[model samples]
Target: MINSITQNALRALLYEVTTEPKPGLVDPGSPGPHSDMNIYTFIDSSLSLTQYFNDAVKIGQTFTGSDLTQMFFALRRKGLAAEKAMLAATHGVNTHKGAIFALGVFTCAESYCHTRHTELFTTIQAMCHGLVEHDLGHICSPQTAGEKEYAEYGYGGARAEAEQGYPIIEEIALPFLKDSTGTIQARLLDTLMKIATRAVDSNLIKRAGNIQVIDWLHEEAAAYLALGGYATDAGKQKLKQLNQECLEHNYSLGGCADLLIVTIFVGLERGYL
Candidate 1:
């Protein structure tokens, strides 16, 4: 039973990483998707972190309950092992670094919720409460995209998002997942664009060297969504066009990609998607 949650978590990870036509993300069938990494890198990263996900599940299942602080710490230690395995697998490429963080929390949260048979969002909130304040608030110098975005723009990036129990995922992705009627791939594709249109997406901003890039992404994604998203025939063409647009400019919606994974993980845990 404990390992089953880990396996489900792996499915969420695999589903996120392998889905194609995802604008600017590494996916199967995209021969030369992004310059820095490829589909193989993402597959390697996901496969390498299996044990870490399982370990977090075991730790969460064994936890004594109401100890979110300690659960988070244990997950972090487990996260480090995942990161090491990722680096080894990808040969130093940061394929799923954001995923490692988000999925680590999700795994721990899932473990706790499973052990207690609690609601997914409630347990996730408890697991990640004070994340930004306790972990990222004291950074003297912001270096990474998340930290720099927090320091400069006051956008907490993933930490702030998690601390708030992922408002964006709840408000945007989950609703889309529940209401949208289509195959899982079609629905997830639409939801991914929906998130792309709204998320702060620090990864896109950092890589493009400015915030305007994400703004453009928002506009482009909104326009594609306006055409009916990935559910319609025209929307499919629009999505492909958007993919070409991003690929031409070397754009990657990695931040939104992470949230997409979060959305999928939550949906899976809650049996919504």
Candidate 2:
């Protein structure tokens, strides 16, 4: 769970990303059929990733009013090196914290746009299917030790899903925020670690391949919120209640991994992801 401060700040940014429109990236009007509470960002990296990275550096520098931008750029060099070694995508990658921000953006997009647009929904499902194929490989394939861990760690893991694609997604997601360095940082990192473990899986094809991916993502978010710290009393209570309901239905904790996605999005929407 992200510390209250980082979580709040991240939530604020996500809200801005969804509710406000900036040039050369996502147009708030284009995604279509939006609501006051529901917001969206274009998911394709080509549209907003570079601008978002630049804007984040600018915002960070402005917030701290130091030489952090150049410092951030410098740190990015090493991150680039690390990414290259891993053969990963580096488009939106600048820091690990960016992954949280990106997830927030994804949640917003899903909540606002894709869920409503039949065309986009079909496209997204295809993208999801592609993501499953790209990240998961053949669902029916044999399991290795890594695969076994993937099957057990979160929603997809219990059904014997693989984990190769999850790390790759994480690698692509890095590089948006500064490293965790304070109490808030630790909390954010902890939250990030928890979500990172489950987010991709919640969105992937289930091991049994039976349910909507978002259903699991929502459950994961509720579980995380139920964990107490960093949440409002109401948020905590709501999540706790949801967790109980989920348990009553016999869903495993791992099955609710999408909670990370939901938590980030809902938190961002409510000004807390």
Candidate 3:
């Protein structure tokens, strides 16, 4: 029997790689802000994490008692293994660090939902209670780019998003994705652009060292959306311009890029998109 959690986790990761014209993100059509990482790199990263996803599903499937802490620790073990696999696949490049965290949560949360026969969204949210303050909010030396950004800007990044079960995915990207009209690719492209205009991406801060950059990026995207945003001739030209600007600035809306996958995963699980 196929496990929905594992299937959906892989599907979400694949969706992240396959979606095209994702401005400031890696895609088969374009390499955004990265010379080494491409669609193939992401594919390799996904392949490396396959066993971790399966293990996550198994964690929830095999849980018996009421202690979610055990599941969290078990997930940590799998998460560490998955990180090692991702590093090996990318030759130490961080291709899907954000994807690993986001997808791992969904993978485990879906398994919990399936095993409990409960609704998924709430289950995922419940699984992530007190996530940030416990996991990433504690005092520690800033060792990573994201950690430095978090310490300075207080954006909360992926940890904050996970703490709330990713409200950005639940509220913004998913709605835009579900309600978008046209082909699936077109809809997702629109969703990606729409999402960029709404929130402060931690990756943007990590790259640009300011929260204002995210807002500026949002304004640019909002302007493009007003011009019909990848749905019309003018919008396509504008998108190209935006793509160049992202490359020139050496910044990627990678945080939004990561959440887009989670949004797609949620959409599939909820059966709307």
Ranking by TM-score: 3, 1, 2
After superposing all C-alphas onto the true structure, candidate 1 shows an RMSD in angstroms of 2.0
Per-residue lDDT, model 3, residue 28, is 89
Sliding window of 10 residues with minimal summed lDDT for model 3: 118-127
* Clash number by candidate, in order: 0, 13, 0
| Candidate 2 residue-wise lDDT, 1-273, digit = tens | 333333433443443334312111112443212111112322222223333333433333233223323433343443344334222332433222333333322332333232344231222232223333343455455365334434454333412221122332233212211222334323342344345334444323333244464455445554554554233465445444544543344333222222333334334434442
Provide the overall lDDT of each model, using Cα atoms, as 2-decimal numbers. Answer: 0.81, 0.34, 0.79
lDDT value for model 2: 0.34
RMSD of 2: 17.4
Strongest candidate by lDDT: 1
Superposed on all Cα atoms, the candidates' RMSDs to the truth, in angstroms, are: 2.0, 17.4, 1.9
- Tell how far residue 149 is off in model 3, in angstroms: 2.3
Q: Give the TM-score of candidate 1.
A: 0.92
Q: How would you encode candidate 1's per-residue C-alpha lDDT over 1-273 as one tens digit per residue?
A: 337677777778888877767888877767334677787788778888889888888887888856576777888888888888999998998888888888888887777777788766667677778888886789998777778877777778888777777778888888888787778888888888888888988878887877777678889889988999777888999988988877787777888889888788878876877
| Per-prediction TM-score | 0.92, 0.26, 0.92
- Poorest stretch of ten by lDDT in candidate 2: 30-39
